[model samples]
Target: MGWSWPANPALWPLARELVKATETRQAAKSPLPHERETVAEIRHKTEASNGDNVDRTSAYLTFFRKHPEVHWALLAHLVSRNAGWSMTDLRGELLPRLLPANVQQDYFSFLERGNWLIFHDAYPQLLLYEESVKRQTTLFHLLPELHVSVFMQAVWNHFWKTGDSKLLTVGLIMNEQHYLETHMMSDETYQTTVVKTLPFALQEVLRLNLILFPYRAEGQEDGALRLAGAPVFHFASLAERIELGKRLYSLLFTSLRLREGAIQWASDKPHTGSRKDFWPHLFHDLRETAPGKAHQKKLGGCQLLPGANRLYSPALRHVWKQVRHEAPKAADWYPATKGVMRQLLLSREQPASFCAEEAYCQALEKIERAVLAKGKLFGS
Candidate 1:
């Protein structure tokens, strides 16, 4: 059966309270009561004042100053990380306890609000939250147990070929999510990667969760499942970022659901409809238009500078790399040629250049076509 999750709009005063509490925190020089060594104080003290660390701090403070409501997201990041939040756990114990099915509609609400905000440093409070380390370490050890429990409930999506009830696996086949959409593997090797890698990804999630919140219960695990610890090519002494470029290109091809100049994402299923009902509609007007094969939407700010970064638990933002039910057109592939090269060259000066982003996407497009043959042969 296709999964279905109906929307549970806000019922409890959680949203309102969260907003008010956050506002209070931001107003008082953005410090906690009894908080020592403030961000402002630290900023005042730090010698290194350039790059993302400095820039994000400035943006972080300025963003909060303007959008105090964003504090809810910030708080969510802190609480979920410390609480060791897990979607599987929530469905099994936490949600039922925090909000039983009997009272779910009354006390808790689940909304598929896509990626929340643009990427930015969420660690501005690390200095104030002294207990974060102890809390995260405790959570780290709990991963193995959580892993077993979570794995037991996992629903493999036509990927796992054969498996016993004791050990289920998404037996990897060469799928579009892989290198140029083509990573052939023996069943043995594929399963090994799945086994060794799942836990690694989980650990990565925990580490990332400490600083960001990837809410699996919210169906935000797609990116984590899709992406891996820096691709093997990252360490190779290639002249240019050949591996990184290919991975990035493949990622763009398999992940994004490009829309009307905006990136269409397969959001976490809400508590409103079947996952099936929800998914098919995404590509309808947004990703696919009439005369579908001619022109494809370009990946731009819609993807790279997503607004969801602030809305999602910060951890989710990090794993937002993997997406599902992607629909890339044959026309979407590339020219990793001079364009991508040019973008790479220019990116040093322009951190987030549309040209650079587009070039990589085009590169992915080229690679996909080379591997999969314009997606049409594969009936894209």
Candidate 2:
């Protein structure tokens, strides 16, 4: 991949200066009293909001409202909401029938760990940025104390100087995915137990890799909601994940209906880790049918089939206990400047407008058929 300077010619020099400053700061031994206090306060806030899916989701939205220039906050909020939905799905109606108990537990652990680790690494950075904006000075030097990647230190400094939101967003997308590359994706336990399993392969075949953004389209009635997002292919590849994040960011911000409608929906609806948050007619937080009963297909191209029963998509608190996470194994996965610069080029490409209704409906019907087939074969 060819790496190039940011579009603004001035940024090349600014990047060099920030990189040098970060290197110099990393050699320091201790912080001043006020700096120590600032670190403590930010750490406290990060922990307070890091409690669970609900807390983290709200924290991201709150931060985005306060500091809209940091585009990654809203992106994180929406993506984290999806993570919560995935967590609940392990214990929801269809997955329980398809996957055994032990497999479900492992899958939950896998999803939860990735969710926890990303927040752990990213939240402190957001707090530091907040503090920087208040004090009118860059505070990213303290990032080393919080164990954030050096890549972010430079990116934050550049953003503070230039106010380039797009570059900053892509920078975050690159940093966090690489952060997971070592801690979660490359780990022996998750690799053997989750990623390499037959069930994992089934995720691709069933179209579960789609990251959906629900919104009410223009000229549509208030009661109607629709889905728009690109399917994530080759998720195991770091390059692919970065591309997926950029494509999603583009889709969300570039389209008028998606941007306004999604913000309105998220603002009005509190996330409870249920599909019902967006499509209440198709999904319910409570079980409406007995377990092992054949589920009637409720979906017809993203709208419910007429008079169909709602699917049981349980809330996070109802299905799974709050998880206590072990500290992430320490490693800085930042590549050289040449490699990081290559990711910036992806932000320049405009992704075509995506509508996920067809893909999502197909996946739902496939799961419904699987659940019915398993019920008949085992007579459960």
Candidate 3:
């Protein structure tokens, strides 16, 4: 298992599905018109600035317009590969400079107004947190009548139009312990980028992870936000551990969907060549980048992460690593112990996606394949 996912009975299905995900591969897209020009401009600036130059605002727009999730991957790489850095970089460091002048203020306004989505567990109109998304496109019914940023609204509108609210799953946003009072990333850059990116479904997931970084910090004994116990962590004994397992699954699901989705979208968008063809290709950037020392420290001795985006990768992996994979001590780490992950497998009748729905289906089907392969629900 060197440099690979662990061998836990609970994780094999996820591991198997993940393998299948890469098997078909997240298909890439053709390059958009401005990519080559943008790359040349970026390279010229990087060279001129001694390799630390930023992409031009025009190039930024075209790049994101072609691959909105690419920035999420980049940000993930930075956080996971480097240590001590936080989401604050998105605002103080990245956005103001990365975005054009005309939209900066509007972008800031989205941050100020995004308190609606970040702080509330549920609006009166929205459905309470449920495991299933009901196969509906828009989470508009999931939101309250409030002033949100232009960027968040686009995601809202897309889900409204498409009804694929898996991107807006409730556990990420609705759990007060997890989200309410969470420091919303509120970065103006993301607001700007989200508007131009290819898939509108992913913005909420990116936003959720940006804010989630504070708690994920390994050594932040006194960080601004601390979820020593999150989601169902405070529940009574056995019940609490059972719930924690579910929360872990939610994190895994969101990250993989976005990762696999990026793979699918990457091929169609124009930017580079085949996996080995270009200097910096999608998977090269997404998967090939080694975990940074800082991230390794946070992961401690964990074998792998939960999703394509390293930042949003499972913190539970760190938790599992904390006890060094000892089965007897599982209850010491969390209220629930062995065989818990089997309880959280993606259901067969889960809601359908309006687009890239097959990615969700294909990924889940791997679990069925896992079941077939192992001859049991717990595919060890």
What is the lDDT of every predicted structure here? 0.24, 0.81, 0.28
| Candidate with best TM-score | 2
User: Model 3: runs farther than 4 Å from truth?
Assistant: 1-91, 117-194, 197-380
Model 2 residue runs over 4 Å out of place are: 1-11, 294-307, 335-338
Residues 150-208, model 3: lDDT tens digits? 22333334434344433223222223222222223323455345434432233233221
Clash tally for model 3: 22
Q: Which digits, one per residue and each the tens of the lDDT, describe model 1 over residues 1-380? A: 11112122321122232233334333534234322433344334321221222132233334333433233222222222222222222222112322335333211111110111111112222221222233432111111111111111121111122222111111011111121221122224433443244433443333321112112222443332111112222111222334333333333323223110111121232111111112221112121223323223222422422321111111222212222222112221111212221121212221121223233234333332332343445443
Question: Per-residue lDDT tens digits of candidate 2, residues 78-183?
Answer: 8988889888888887788889999999998988888888888999999999888888888888888888877678788888878888888988998899888878
Candidate 1, residue 101: how far the Cα is off, in Å: 28
Give the deviation of candidate 1 from the true structure as CA RMSD. 24.4
Which has the higher lDDT value, candidate number 1 or candidate number 2? Answer: 2
Arranged by lDDT with the best first, the candidates are 2, 3, 1
Q: In candidate 1, what residue range of length 10 has the lowest lDDT sum? A: 166-175
| Between candidates 1 and 2, the TM-score winner | 2
Leading candidate by lDDT: 2
Write down the TM-score of every candidate: 0.19, 0.93, 0.20
Clash count, one per candidate: 29, 0, 22
